[model samples]
Target: MKLLMTTAVSALVVLGSTAAMADIKLGASLSASGPAAFLGDPEAKTIEMMVDQINEAGGINGEKIDLVLYDDGGDPNKARTFATRLVEDDEVVAIIGGSTTGTTMSILSVAEDAEVPFISLAGAIQIIDPVRRWVFKTPHTDRMACEKIFSDMQQKGITKIGMISGTDGFGASMQAQCKDVAPKYAIEILADETYGPQDADMTPQLTKIRNTDGVQAILNPGFGQGPAIVTRNKAQLGIDLPLYESHGVASDGFIKLAGAAAAEGVRLPGTALLVAAILPDSDPQKPVVTAYKAAYEAKYGETVSTFGGYAHDAVDLMTNAMKTGGSDPAAIRDALEATQGYVGTTGIYSFSPEDHLGLDLSAFKMLEIRDGGWTLID
Candidate 1:
């Protein structure tokens, strides 16, 4: 009877300890390798670092976070599989990833069906335009990027332009959005061209744009190495018109890949984080962006990209929501939706029932590439 009582007491103590140490599970799916690795790699690093920081700072409500992260390798099918595993097998309370638009869309279905709070890091308007109940995103949409670019072009009196886009999901979506809204900004896309994601050369497509009638400038809407290749091809062809790229390739890697001579004079839309150092003292976002830039560069030893900023914002949004919502998925979703005036590396976020992506055109800053570095134009 004494032995049995001792065993029972030990078992009860173990159970109590297990209950006391229960973790809040969070899941993420990213393309940390393959073609889109540049975007996903930094994003994965930021998420891991942020989770570690949170746990080190006593975690949320005294519960440590159990992060379940997967590398989708830029494949949508793989993203779907991982998202399903996160929902059904891992049973995570919330998710905060999707490194690209394709992967984000793939994970969106699972998140919606499972009713899990998901904060995506992709830059596609479609991800949040229809506004699924459980889905939100951190990056400024490609449409906003388009509008921002056109707004700059209008100021420069550039009315007609040529476009060369990649065949990838993000490239195709932004291409459509740019075309659809070109008229609103009084800009006409006179020449349209395209390239495959794996194509090494884009001279032929750019040559056609260079020779097109009334083409005042060129816009390349794509991610990965395609835009860098396009920049090189344009330089080789000596196409001197102003070149505008999407926010997709807003990284120093792009400039390095394209070569300094080729990438010079290139303009694009980017977040304040890219120009954090130059921001004035009174700017509200200056402190937030500078802190993030400093921390990210210090830890990773690489120049911080806007892609990493997206991950930073997503983690912050999720963790802030978790503060009030605890471990309940529905309550977390509500808390995320109610987010307001949250300053982040990307922009000031304020979510609502109608708008899942809580950013305006003001969130984007027009940037020019000069001497192998980013220069703020606006």
Candidate 2:
């Protein structure tokens, strides 16, 4: 992970490029500063770190990457402006963003019209449907997580469940998917409740579910402050039913924010970011994960979360496509569409015109917090 003196200086030079045509311009619009800032902060940091590493390793196709970042503040209007600026003013060949569904959804049309490639860190499946040829995604969709959660629950002989979702785009989409797929697994949802994104308490919602007759477990399809609050209140209110989180709550930060007593025994699907410490040796992505972890921890002094892993993979995938396609948007789109077995910080990404999401349900593992750390449960 040590960078040579020449490589480090060259990397600085590459990052300093201001002209549109000087190097490979990559634009990213994320919630860099907002209520959801933690989500995008890691993503931005990972991009910076990965760009430095790639540049240090002789750059991509001998043209260094010039990554441009914007803080959308989790606002749709701001995201649109940033996306437009990147495509029109900054003249970036492609865009990479790690905001939630609401912001990313607003920027999609602009990216499509500009005919620039966009790789998203958000997990809403609707973003890729109708499949914008210029758009790609690295995060596991909410529907995929719903499938995994319901399947895993069935395997564990849990059928009666209660639902709690945040009143946000990501939470809404996940809730709908859970409703649609719940019947498929013969799971009965006894009660459904909702809380606002910034709400500091979910005791009322949990109380309603706990009072319901047949609810045996709670399904929390929320993230950020919502999940943290729900976890805290669930323990304080003495809700003894098992708690299942959506894939959005994969970071160690969730455990820290939610508190050990509340976060304990919580089950959720494992993102590639969560398994760096326990990846199978035969996994093709082991080396890349190892290298990314070492360098990221060395620079930042902590573990990389799922958001960071997704952003890192986004750049790696786009860079690989650019290298293969030689900076042409159409060719890069085709190249990305044809990707297969792309080992990255996220899972091995393989995209096609028909299936933009490369990884399957098996890509996730079950995780629980035990002894103040993430432990794979299944």
Top candidate on lDDT is 1
Quote the RMSD, in angstroms, for model 1.
6.1
What TM-score quantifies how close candidate 1 is to the native fold? 0.90
Q: Name the runs in model 1 displaced over 4 angstroms.
A: 1-21
| Structural similarity to truth (TM-score) of each candidate | 0.90, 0.90
lDDT of 2 at 215: 84
Question: Taking the tens digit of each residue's C-alpha lDDT, what string does model 2 give over 283-308?
Answer: 67778888888888899998787788
- lDDT (C-alpha) at residue 230 in model 2: 93
1-378 per-residue lDDT for model 1 (tens digits): 999999998996675356333489999999999877888999999999989999999999998998889999999999999999889877899998888888899999999999999999988888998989999999998899999999999999999999999989879989999999999999999999999999999998998998888999999999888999999999999988999999988877889999999999999998888888778788799998898888888998999988889999999999999999989999999999999999998889999999999999889989999999889887
* lDDT over C-alpha atoms for residue 114 of model 1: 97
| lDDT of model 2 at position 74 | 89
lDDT of each model, Cα atoms only? Answer: 0.91, 0.85
